[model samples]
Structures are given as structure tokens and as C-alpha cells.
Target: MTMTSPVALTERQCTLIARALAEPRRYQILKEIAGQGGSVACACMQQKHEVTPATLSHHMKELENAGLIEIVREGKFATLVLKRETLDAYLRELASL
Candidate 1:
């Protein structure tokens, strides 16, 4: 069987992603960012989630750490972009099992 994803994810990365997504709010946050298509503003996320700034930051940090998203900072504004390749790799790995 031909089985391989173009992008590869390390076991550690997959574990991290699984753990991060295990959190309901984090999963929702990821979905919202993905739904935006690209470059979602942190301010808009906070407003939509109605969570405290610190709480949002924590969630973003976890996603970033899991390599599920990237955070770009300019001045005081922060933007998030979904790491589709990484997510895709993780999904591929899961499907392999």
C-alpha cells in the first residue's frame, strides 16, 4: 500500500497536537481560526470567544507549542494562522493507525 503524507510529523509533535486538541476550548479556537481561512486577528478571537485575555493567550500558546498554529506579532497586534500542513500530517499519521 502506498502510504505516506507529503509532510511528516514527529511522534512528539503528534502527541502535543493530540493533547492540545483534547481541550474543548482549544479545539474550538483552532476551528475558528481555520474557519477564518487565514491570518485571524487575536483581538477578534478574544471578542468571539468572550474569554479573558490571559486565558486566550494561554490557549494560543498551547496551539503554537503543538505546531498547530503560528502567531505573528506586529506592534501590539497579534494574528494567527492555521498550520494546515502540520495538521494534515497529524491527520495522516492518525489515519495510518
Candidate 2:
């Protein structure tokens, strides 16, 4: 799939991305998903981070809204996958600064 280039991002999108990453817990959540190299179950993340279900849901929503991750829902379970292209684009934008 084609990826969005961060250089082409609108101001609002940039703000969303920044806000999504501003919290330490959210950053850690992203790192954990990335480290998995594929989709990670929400249950796994909850155990790894020791976060409450409600808190995890909030963090996942932020990541999804920012285009930083994709969530696949199967039954009552959800799995998270990092949007590597989005991250690459963000890095590229940073390097341009």
C-alpha cells in the first residue's frame, strides 16, 4: 500500500500526530507495537504495560486517530499494528527541519 508523506501533511494532521505522541505512556505503547514486528493483541499490550482496559482503549484511539496505527477488531478482541509509513514520513519531516 502507498504511504502518506509527512511533508504533505496538513497542519491539523501534524497536530494530531504530535498530540498522539506527547504522552510517555502512549509513546511506550507505540514502541511495544512496533517491536512486535506485526499486529499485537490488546490483551498482550495490557499485560505488558500494566494499563487498565479503559486507559489502553484511550491510548489506542489516539494512535488510530493520528494515523500512527491500525486496529483490527476480531470478535471482542483487538490487535494493533504500527503504521510504519506514517512513522517514516514523520521522521523524514523531522530530518528536513
Whose TM-score is greatest here?
1
Error of 1 at 69 (Å): 0.4
- Angstrom error of the Cα, residue 60, model 2: value is 0.7
How would you encode candidate 2's per-residue C-alpha lDDT over 20-50 as one tens digit per residue? 9999998999998888895799889988877
> What C-alpha lDDT does candidate 2 achieve relative to the native structure?
0.86
Candidate 1 matches the true fold with a TM-score of: 0.92
RMSD of 2: 2.6
Model 2 worst lDDT run, 10 consecutive residues? 4-13
Residue pairs in collision within model 1: none
lDDT by residue for model 1 (24-94), tens: 99999999998999569999998898789999999999999999999999999999999998998899999
**lDDT, model 1:** 0.93
lDDT of 2 at 49: 77
lDDT of each: 0.93, 0.86
List residue ranges in candidate 2 displaced over 4 A: 1-7
